[model samples]
Target: MTRSELIAQIKQKKSFLCVGLDTDLTKIPEHLLDEEDPIFTFNKAIIEATSDLCVAYKPNIAFYECYGLKGWESLQRTATILPKDCFSIADAKRGDIGNTSKMYAKAFFDPQVSGFDFDSITIAPYMGKDSVTPFFEFKDKWAIVLALTSNEGSADFQNIENAEGVQLFEQVLEKVNSWGSIENTMYVVGATRGEAFLKIREHAPDHFLLVPGVGAQGGSLSDVCQYGMNKDCGLLVNSTRNIIYASKGTDFAEQARIEAQKLQKEMQIELEKAGIC
Candidate 1:
């Protein structure tokens, strides 16, 4: 999807919620195990239940890759089942040298290469421009660079400052923005880092942000929208464990729907408050 298409979806849905398909086979209801592919079964239910309530779905690749071939199959099935209008992302956090990165790009962006053609893929910027530039080689696809993550370990490197006193992440946002326009580039800013949002926005006010750390992670939806929303409502706030695994029983999908609805309703209010509605 192009940037304008994403912005249009946000407007039409009155939401910026991005549901995370971090599907773990061990965590899904045991009943689903009867199916040939329990992971895909769980994901299909979650997508069907929450599709109308949110604008995007992100499948974290590690969850599938750990399980080997079957896990990968589930990831492909999940991607195929997602709503067409809703944005899709492969949370692979992939980056390598130019040539290698090109293969990773083909894996996620090429429908023929990856089985699942995602609208975007999460990327790591620590390797510099060659690592990221390859992903943008595809048409209408996106590269969501990791700027400030929610993990506790982020403080180890992202927070370190240089002589100019600029945090490493801030420097990343500044430098990486040069490689792609706001139309194709995005930054991953954890919702837990709500305090850093204002400063983060100061560097790239117009680009979209893929925000995780809400719900089970305890990142406040209200606080995230208050500081991170731009004129185009540039945020894809995500919730994973909280929504998908809300219940482990037969009514799991229903429970997931309720959880997704709560977040969507909260987002509706935030949009109105920001006068973006």
Candidate 2:
């Protein structure tokens, strides 16, 4: 999707919620195990139940890669059925040399080569520009670079102060923004880093942010919006276990919808408060 299209969806839905399809076979309803492709079956139901309430669906790649060939098949089927109105994210945190990065980008963005046609892909910035630039070559697709992650270990590298007294992540935000326009680039700013959003916005006021760690991770939604929200409501707050696994029974899809609705209502309120709705 183009930048304008994404902003339009946020306004139309009165939401910026991104539902994470970090589906685990063991965590899905037991009955689905008998299905030929249990992962895709579960994902289809969840997408059907909550597509109207969310603007994005991010399937963390590892969740599918772990199951080998069958896992990839499931990922393909799930991607094919994703709502056209919603953004599709291959949450594959890949980073490597130049040539290798091109293949990774093709895996998510080029449907002619890979079965999934994703709107964005998460990228680790450790390898610098070559690792990230390939994704930008794909028109209208996004490269969501990791900035301030929510994990405790993030402090080890991301928070380490540089010679200019700037944190490593801040430097990343500044440099990556130079490579592409806000239209094609975004940063992964974890919701757990509430006040950090303030720091991030100083560097990326117009760029969208793919925010995780909200619901199940105990990140405050109110705190995130207070500092991170831009005029376009440039934030996609993802909820994974909290919504998709709301119930492990046959009523799982219904429960997921309820959870998704709750987040959508909260997002609507935030959008109105920001005067974007």
The per-model lDDT (C-alpha) reads 0.91, 0.94
Judged by whole-model lDDT over C-alpha atoms, candidate 2 comes out at 0.94
What lDDT tens digits, residue by residue, belong to model 2 across residues 1-277?
A: 9889999999999989999999998899999999988899999999999999999999999999999998888898898899999998899999899999999999899989986689999999999988889999999999999999988888999999978899999999999999989999999999986898999999999999999999788799999999999999999999999999999999999999999999999999999999999
For model 1, name the residue pairs that clash: none
What lDDT score goes with residue 215 in model 2? 79
Cα TM-score of candidate 2: 0.99
At residue 48, what lDDT does model 1 achieve? Answer: 91
Local accuracy of candidate 1 as per-residue lDDT tens digits, 1-277 = 9999998898888889999998887899999999999999888888999999999999999999999998888888888888989999999999999999999999998988667689999999989999999988888999999999998899999999999899999999999999988888999999886878998899999999999999777788888888998989999999999899899999999999999989888989988888888
Find the 10 residues in a row with the least total lDDT in model 1. 108-117
Give TM-scores for every candidate, taking all chains together and pairing residue i with residue i: 0.98, 0.99
RMSD of 1: 0.8
**Candidate 1, overall lDDT?**
0.91
